[model samples]
Target: MAIFEKTPQTKAILDDTEKLVCTIANAQNINKHTEYILRVHRGVSKEDKWNVSHRYRDFAALHGALQAARRDLPLPPKKLLGNMHPSFIAERQIALQNYINEVLKHTILALSLNVRCFLDPSNYPANLTEQALQTVSIALRGEGRYELKGPLPEIGWRIRKHYFMVTDTESHANCLLCWQSYGPDRHLCDKDLQTAFKCLQNLSHPHIDQILAIHNLETGAYVVRKVHETGTLRDMIYGTEYSKSYLSKYGNPKTRKPLTDGQIAHYGLQLLQALKFLHDKGLPHGHIHPGNIAIENQKVLLLDIENTLLGVANVHRPYIREHRKTSSAEAIDVYSFGRTLYEMALAETLEEPYCDIFPCNMSNDLVSVLRLCLSSSSCKHGMPTIESLLRHPLFSRPLVMGNGVHSDGATSLRVPSQLKEEIKMAVAVMEARLKAEQKLVRGAKREVRIQEILGSEEEMRKQKRRAKKRESVWKSTSSLAETVRSQSVSTASSPTPPHHTSDAPACTNGSSSTSASSAPLASPVAAGGTQQTKVTNEAPATNGRSALLSAICSFDKTRLSRINSE
Candidate 1:
């Protein structure tokens, strides 16, 4: 079945694991799970007991009396299950209970998943409506020996249930992941399922995990996806390497060195490129963070993309599409992701005490953009953007590392350049916006506040722009970095060459310019017989190269603006 088509939950179930559970449950003698009401032709029927009877004993007695009364009666056509014996009713009751219990469990898994639930990988009947009836006949005939069959069963399930031992403190949802399933999942609303399925199938990315298949079983359509046995990013941060530095950031004390700046940049770039690709498809990898990302197939793979959607364009999709009651849309998800990103990225953003000089952990240009994304409607400042952030001085040059405010060695994860540039430019546009505000903070100076305000406004506008830009740039950067990284790794003993046109022009020589004031715009501004140099320090490391390039480009573009302002 096509993943996009929205169909009712007819023959939907994961697998036979539920039946196993039911077998065990019957052995224990617990009441049937009555949540699923019986509809029979409609779905799982919920009518209680036989006829109007509620108690099991009453059902047994009623059926028993009827059988006894008809003892001499021409033996009611012995076609259905071993013609009713004296105790057949009681046996039938137990068998029906078993069937109901097993079906219920399987149904639950297909409906929703949590730590305690998962999908079963198994076969199902082609025609789901009569799956149980067909199964008995098929089993009696010894597998494929049945020759009197008409059309074969097309869609149904082999899914059953099993009793899973769970704990009180740890919820069932904390562990189980779906291995497979059938049809429209209750929790995975049609919209989300369709969107996620499309993303999983159509993305066709090498770094992304490929969906193996989509099935159209009678239970409904289901999908098969690749699983990474390795682990998740969260497992690494909380449990493994690069832990020591991050220990201080949290209450837990652990020792592990943070990833080197280079590593962060490398992975961060990959993420941005991936997001860019999604954007190109009129979608957004809304949840773009280290935890949601994975290293697989020798590259990073984005997980949980089914939860995301097209960027700003879909902000108002609910109003347009008369479908699911979705209070939470993809845009909201993106904004939420941005908040998460502010916490996980480099030290500067993490240590943000004031809005003015919020460091551009990615590219200086993207800080403003990141800021806009970081802003909320409740905040006095408006939304930020990528292009404006790019214009900010933070992105105008490469970033310097050592300004961490967190103690106990809080290692910084470099914001990806794609993110960096996107945010920086966004922030610039946001900060410069002339939007009217109701009131102002009493203590903050207008001059100082103006910069913050203007910077914020400019960044907001730029962020929207960056979201639309081609993500291929990230791939281009990755290709270049990979070449450099491999070559650099191989030539560990060799002395590195001098800075040149190939390296950074402004930073060719180590002594190029440590101070931002040394740029062409760093001329003397005379005041009271003294030339007061407005100093802006460049961020350290590879970020510096990015900033230097940005600065050169900005300078080249704004000759007219600079001349006019001067």
Candidate 2:
């Protein structure tokens, strides 16, 4: 009577689940943009798949699965989840009650104590385990309490938009932990998720995928993520077009080599910098691959964190019979990361130059570290840390080396006296990071205090929250009204891209065609490869007259050096 037998509706739901979960290239999402499916349309289309029936059935099955594990594992505490917001706790209670009343007849106390959990992807702690996910309780809306559900597995589901991913009940219990123990941190759950989704949100390293806002409502919490268009990196590099272009850019021009030593070093360094940023934060992406690396608007993004492993073994839910030993579990991630690097690099070079002709592109010297990892004996050298790989002899070298600084030699990415300024900027970045972290800790602590106090007095808390939410809505409405009012004032403002006047030409030669634009356009190099970056072109013509574009096409490398050294 519990688990579903063969039914058209159930089968349909299962099919949708498979499609969403198994789809290649593109990561999927709950199509909340679409109208909610009514009872009749519930399994009719893919868009209708996330309806009430689907959640109910999924939760039921999850609970059944977790109950089987409860005999052996005790549920972990709430702090293991992450920053949960008090408003979220209250909101979920209100939402859950409304949603459940329509389907199940259960009292709050009889079912689950109203608890909110926060699961942190930050530093992914190992204290939480598979058993921890099993038999956790979920809050029943009617009674404002929790009942045993299933384990919160990090498997497919997300909660509160960016907290713990549980396939079972403990995730439910963990949600409560935020409500009960750390009130303020819990309150931030919504904000944390929301802030993460906001664009140009340069908090995480450039690569790591971001979390947006967590929407906790009547039914469940929805973890929000960004919309990716170009699909995953795995599908990209493996495809024919991406591979070819990648090679042409990085490969030798004459031999059409797959990649030059310089190019390998450059791309490898980029990956290293990205990884270092994550690892230093104690966030080692357990699943680093081209597939997880997404490209949005030409920006590289590391996606899929639910499987991301941190410093510990207990954080990830294992599908296969995994080595429960923490060391082995953690070590496995490094190898996986290494292999993924190899796969991406290999795919990037799987072209003609790389395979046969180009000696440079196919050189074994390329990404020696990744090549070592790909060899049958991955991590054979006592599993060198990512830190070590970053500092490896090969990785530390410059991308496109020419000659040495001391000797009578040439160089690339010129070094000059002005480099002192860049150093200052880099130092400032470090100081800013420390200050930001301190502020975050203080803020989270303050919220925790407010939540604890508010949590104790429920009826009063409810009234205040309502007033606040309503106030927010009013403010939003008022802002919109103000925008409408300002629509008249917009006549004073002009909207246009700043274009050059007649005297100033877009190209040095003033040619309209950018494709045929002079060599100086590619770089500020002079005609004879001298760095003359400051070589200003002749003044633009005052009259509506044309001039030869050849003058604009000139470059001076010596000028470039002076600008750098300045």
Predictions in order: lDDT: 0.35, 0.35
As a whole number from 0 to 100, the lDDT of residue 516 in candidate 1 is 27
lDDT of 1 by residue, 310-369 (tens): 111121121112112112223333343344344444321232212334443454434544
After superposing candidate 1 on the true structure, give the runs of residues whose Cα lies further than 4 Å from its correct spot.
1-202, 215-223, 227-229, 240-261, 296-298, 308-337, 346-370, 376-566
Candidate 2 wrong stretches, greater than 4 Å: 1-202, 215-221, 240-265, 296-299, 306-330, 348-361, 376-381, 400-566
Model 1's TM-score against the true structure: 0.30
lDDT of model 1, residue 324: 20
lDDT of 2 by residue, 1-566 (tens): 11432212211011111111110111112442111121212211235332222222332333333342222222222232321445443443344334433222211111111110111122123333331332123333322333333332222121111123222233332221111011111111233323322321234454455644223322223333444434455545544222122222222222221323554454455555566655443334454545456655444566544322101111121210111111232244455555555545454422110122222554455456654443333433334566776677666665423222112222112222333233234334423432343354346557778898778788688899999999999999999999987986774563433333566545553335443343334444234433232222343454213333343344333354334535
Evaluate model 2: give its TM-score.
0.29
lDDT of 1: 0.35
